[model samples]
Target: MNPDNAATMVAIEIQQPGGPDALIPAERPVPSPGKGEVLVEVAAAGVNRPDVLQRRGFYPPPPGASDLPGLEVAGEVVAAGEGATHLIGERVCALVAGGGYAQYAVAPAGTCLPVPESLSMAEAAALPETVFTVWHNLFERGAAVEGEWALIHGGTSGIGTTAIALCRLFGVKAAVTCGSDDKCAAALAQGAAAAINYRTQDFVAEVQRLTGGRGVEVVLDMVGGDYLPRNVQCLAEDGRHVSIATQRGVTAELNIMDVMRRRLHLTGSTLRPRSTAFKTALAEEIRREVWPFVESGQLRPVMDRTFPLREAAAAHARMEAGDHVGKIVLTV
Candidate 1:
């Protein structure tokens, strides 16, 4: 583990975006930290849906973002660049720009957060991406408040589970939709007020029933398209629906009448495309509002599985399977 050694590292690369087979293992030089960044000896990296999309070539990293496939990682800082005074040799979990799929990754100093003492490296790796996304969408954009009702699609997902836990901690009531009974039970155990099995029940109707026909105040949706119209229908007046991904479909026949009648606001965003300044602000918010909960053991990341770094392709395959209850990690 000499800092000066240019170690051979294995990374999952996409030769041609298509399916799970596209994620091929390759040997490459370990990257060095640049100004205001730190080079981490990655202990673990989280496998996210965006990584899967990137592998398929449907989504490419934003300009200056990492060309490799990882979005978040937890590891020990092996080296720090100029101006990165606080992070040398520190164990941390960070929201990465790219390059997380490798054995080593460089992260901006400001986006790195101290790992909770109680968390495993695998759990720490799982936190940054889903926690950041949920915080940004639910509290920042959706303005989910105490006592307000929040609806989340894919309730058993990493983001969904994180959102449900945070909402419970903050006194927000959450109703989530999952595909299976076991997933519903998992979401409920994580503090979702109600869980609807989407395969067996109409989520809109179930939400209506759960909320006493008033609808929820916020909706965090990843499945777009058909969910779009029903998301509007399941909103209270002035509800905000934030779409983070279009797993279902992008386009939808929106009933403008529902939009006008409910005054619902539909919005969406991607984390990688945001400027460093924006990401810094998000980091600050997490530090101020969320980190304490993590530090105190009130909010813990849900990790369902882990794969060795060399098994990154298999990790991606697991995520694509869509049966996982929480985050998946690649242990380096």
Candidate 2:
């Protein structure tokens, strides 16, 4: 590798997983594109919950994935691997297995999506991970549809904001729960028909009241633990409850009778552990169904704030504080 080329790259690494302090900056060689890959000179990277978990040692990188923390990136493609066409020096955003926290990262050819002509690199970086999660959990598995009611927990989160925008674009009525009145208002502004402040309000009763006792058709829940039982109770007949994370805790006792009697469907998944083929299929679906909305400016990322790449620890701290209304980004 040329010394000048090698000198251009930087990365954040975990010396030992623990807390925000674990993210340490270091120099790295600019990676070369391998077969079926493209080398992106990252302009920005999205900060996600999984990055926090990874920094805490609670989540490990999947096989063949980068050991660094970032899961998504937006940048110009600087180099293309052999057999990779249709992309060269193109501004793109991609869902990567890892390596997004670096100044340079490699993305599989199939996973790269054209950055919307309307969005900045920072805004584009925020889309792939959150949009992929929302589409898969809410529409694909949860079977959410137009004119149906969808309830999202953590409504002020990156996932929540994206879900709200997507539901609105799809003509679905959306309700969400957040931590405060301010967060609730933010959620509502993002297209949530109703935003419940979980700290001061009862989400179940609110959902029932909002829907006139019918409840919502689908609940996208990230808060597990005792919320699980109440979540099932808040579901409409034949409703689906998809649990994506256990922020509150995983194990919970729930009434099987409710599930059987209501004919409900309960399902959930994590994206990191999934196969590349699965992600490729998802990327294609996003391109076909969701990309147009982004292109037309109907759906776009809600960026809370951005920090320089060297300030990754501060970014992680802000996310951990739960003060953000949307995605936090690291600009390279």
Candidate 3:
């Protein structure tokens, strides 16, 4: 918050809407956190799907957020604004709208959570975006319950892996679908009760067989083309279907009769553009309901690899390649 200490920091900027090479490293002024904010000396930042979209000039930062290409980071709080002074010296992992691919970034105080003592800075960096998202959509939106079956698509993604771990830790029965047998195996290893290889198996049929034709109580999906109607058929009576992303295509023509016949509840959300108060409430819910599982060692971050902060373009390329298993991180 001090003008004198607002030094310049190296960051990756999107010079234009293009490919990974468009991510150009440059120096930018260190951001000063406003009221109820904290200045993080970033140790590491997570590379997410949204970042990839942002790099391609598709997803822009939310209103009033930085145009930088990062959504989450882990580091120590070097300074705090007005009412956030208590967090000035604490180490934390924070969920942010942007500006994380750097040595220094600003985050809202309420979006920050203490980095677990057992986690390294890199692992901590991988938690915020995926964790907040999984907790929000799966547990909160899906209303996944103990002993109940939940199906997650893209079972090896950051969201999928985190969801699997949280489901296991919370006693939810998980059945996930991945692109390959290897990723399917990885999903099962992460505690999914069953892993379906979408490349080889019919996930709807598999889900039916896995749940004795009752179907899963909740279906978490990001793939939203024909998967939409098929996902509806994969749900149980009165089931909840929550879609967080549409990796295939956005618009889907659904049979209203099918939705009504199954009594399916359809929903979806995007985190970055949300209000700070909304994110603050989600953070509080995570602290109250999810922190214990993290502390008890039931949840651990699964990281694929770490690239230096300046090599953010490479990280984005790797993510686009879709070969990595878990989260890709950028270490400063």
Candidate 4:
């Protein structure tokens, strides 16, 4: 539980960007907390899609960010830099720009949320990236409100499940698209109002049918490429389309006339590469608005599995295999 004088730690680094095997174990000097940061003795770190992309050499860490591939971690704060001393002894889950695939990592004090007694280290580790993304894209940028319906792709993913849970909590209905019937059922069980097996059904038509031809108020899309035009078809007039990731492909051709006529809004964001001040503000807003549900045990990240930190390659392989139904974590 102590990090004092721990000069080195084990980290999973990308030996080369290619495949799961690219992630390799290495010895690294334990990082120090910079001003307004805390050194966390990591208990668990969340494995995310971005980590996979990073491993494949498609995504790289932002400048000044750690090259190691991980975005979130849950741990005990063992040391703190000048302005962050107050967090030195707290249990926290933080969203980091990088360097989470290690036994210890430095995190911005502002991005760290207090881990409540109700949450396990693994579950806490799973929250930051997905929760922040969903909250920002679905509610803030998309402007989804109570009683509205949202269409989310990747129903079984960390982002999808977190979006469903948050939608349920906030009185917004979520209809999700999954690759399989089983994943669809899982999404329904996780509180999605409807789940479409995209592999078997036409999601655009199904969405139209589900909403009785009115269409949903928002579309939370991660699958880009061809899905973007179809997603636009699934939206109601003035509906918002928020793109968080481009899993399918990056390019898409949308009907500008349709967009203009329907008054649909298309917007997307990448959470990394954003300024520290912006993330800090976002963290504060999430703490004030969303932490209550977490503190009350009403919100928790859906966990699929946990792997040992050294088995990070296997973890990435599991994610790429696409059968996991929820968040995956690397236990430290």
Candidate 5:
């Protein structure tokens, strides 16, 4: 690596909120790791829906975070702050608040997971954001256990595919919704118990049919708005509804009496704004529960495409196009 590149790195930044064109390349000073953090010379970064939202001006980085748009990265740790020296020279993948778009990004030591030799830099880069979100929302908050059934929306998306893969590994059955038949097929190929074409079919009715009218035990919803009430209809008695994103719209109207009558549970979470202590705890839990699958090569991200770091705009465009089947990544 060039010594000057260690001091200055090429990063993609949003010049102004609009479209993919808003993301522009620029030279930025390499960020230094703080106490309990490690500085990664990033090899690859994952592109997520949040990155697209940030580019469109809908989502903003949390306070004290880099304005650059990236959530997860995989690379080699070259420098470490206090209490993090042990991680130096280790290949790690991490979930970050922001700044993952740069060549060098600082990550909390606790959030960095060791990258096994079985996975490539691009594949490792794709794990953290989706894995953390699914583990927390599906298993932890939703209380989905083995042998239960889960309904996941956006089946071809990074989160949906991760959820499907985890459900398959953990013995939970997953039924996913997609916009097209091809996507539905893709979801089925990814180990989903069933796939619903939401664009042409009524998912609530389909879920009922698939479960023999008993409905699903859990619903992992990404499309909120009117989908909330519809999602509730797709759940069984004492079912859990976990919302992770509001892709459709935020506000929704629901029948409270119905919720009460069915003994239903509703919950949601956003990972970026959470405290470092909370994220660290989550990281540890995943390291224990899910890392084994990753290390053993039994689990891997379903990759869609990879773009050069300088062409982040093209990556954003691909995500927005909604034609991709899995994770979109940026390689440095």
Candidate 6:
């Protein structure tokens, strides 16, 4: 494929590992697609917790990944690499390891999915990371069955809200825990069966109460540390608990008797370091199981706020403030 006219694109670069102020707008060379990849002219990109962690130097990009921070994007494919010629000119959303915080980015051909025309680029931008994550951890790993009760640890986070929506769409009962009453109300409005105020009430008690004292079938946990033990307690017999992040702390201890008695499955995964083939398989699973809901509007992207591409520092600041209820995005 031929290159675009411009040699470089406006992108966000982390000057150093520190605060959000480290995110500076700068010009960088537009990247070319490799074999089995597509070069996309990005219209918008999703801001996620991993991006913030990377900016703060806690989470470094995997080997050979872009240094730029964005993990997901919505854009038009400008060119395709060998054996991926079908992607050119397609408007799609993709889960990228990095390099999304720019005017142009390259994504694995297998990771790209068609965006529904009804949604804005901003909404589509918000899909890849959250959708793939929820699908992987919540359904694929956690085995959240339809008509079963599930507890989500962070109700208003990008991953949490998407989990709630997908659970509701798939007929699983969803209960979430958030820091504020407003967030609880927001979760309820998004089709969550229940929302617990984690700041005040005990989530274990709330989950028990909401599930009629029977406990839930699955728990989608992002807050690790002490929550790990409590997550196991929140589940029913033969239950599954999946961890996608360790927001509170990394280490925790659990009761040996709890697992033996309940037959619980404790598992966790980090998405960024996985192989392209693994992500490609996940993309296919999402296409068959989740994309219909997205395209039909049964499930919707919950976008809380958006900032200009240049004001990414401000966006990160807002995210750190902990007030927004849904996905934060940057419009290019």
Model 6 CA RMSD to the hidden true structure, in angstroms: 1.1
* Candidate 1, residue 242: how far the Cα is off, in Å: 0.8
State the lDDT of candidate 2 residue by residue for 1-332, as single tens digits.
22246655789998798989899999877778788888888999999999999999988999988899999999988788886655886899999988999999998888899986789999999999999999999999998999999999999899999999999999889999999999998888888999999999999999999999998999999999999999988899999999899999989998999899999999999998888778989999999999999899988899899999999999999999999989999999
Tens digits of per-residue lDDT for model 3 on 138-216?
Answer: 8889999899999999888888889888898889998998989899889888898999999899999998898889999
Q: TM-scores for all candidates?
A: 0.97, 0.97, 0.97, 0.99, 0.98, 0.98
Candidate number achieving the greatest lDDT relative to the actual structure: 5
Off by over 4 Å in 2: 1-4
lDDT of 1 at 207: 87
* Model 6: lowest-lDDT 10 consecutive positions: 1-10
Q: Point out the worst 10-residue segment of candidate 4 by lDDT.
A: 1-10
Q: Assess candidate 6 and give its lDDT.
A: 0.92
Tell me which of candidates 1 and 5 scores higher on TM-score: 5
Which scores greater on TM-score, model 1 or model 6?
6
Superposed model 5: Cα runs more than 4 Å off: 1-5
Whole-model lDDT per candidate: 0.89, 0.91, 0.91, 0.94, 0.95, 0.92
Instruction: Single out the weakest 10-residue window by summed lDDT for candidate 1.
Output: 1-10
**Residue pairs with backbone overlap in model 3:** none
Model 4 clashing residue pairs (backbone): none
Between candidates 5 and 6, the one scoring higher on lDDT is 5
lDDT of 4 by residue, 1-332 (tens): 24568778999999888989989999999998889999999999999999999999999999999999999999999999989999988999999999999999999999999999889999999999999999999999999999999999998999999999999999999999999989998999999999999888999999899899999999998989999999999999999999999988999998899999999999999998898899999999999989999999999999999999999999999999999999999999
Error of 6 at 231 (Å): 1.4
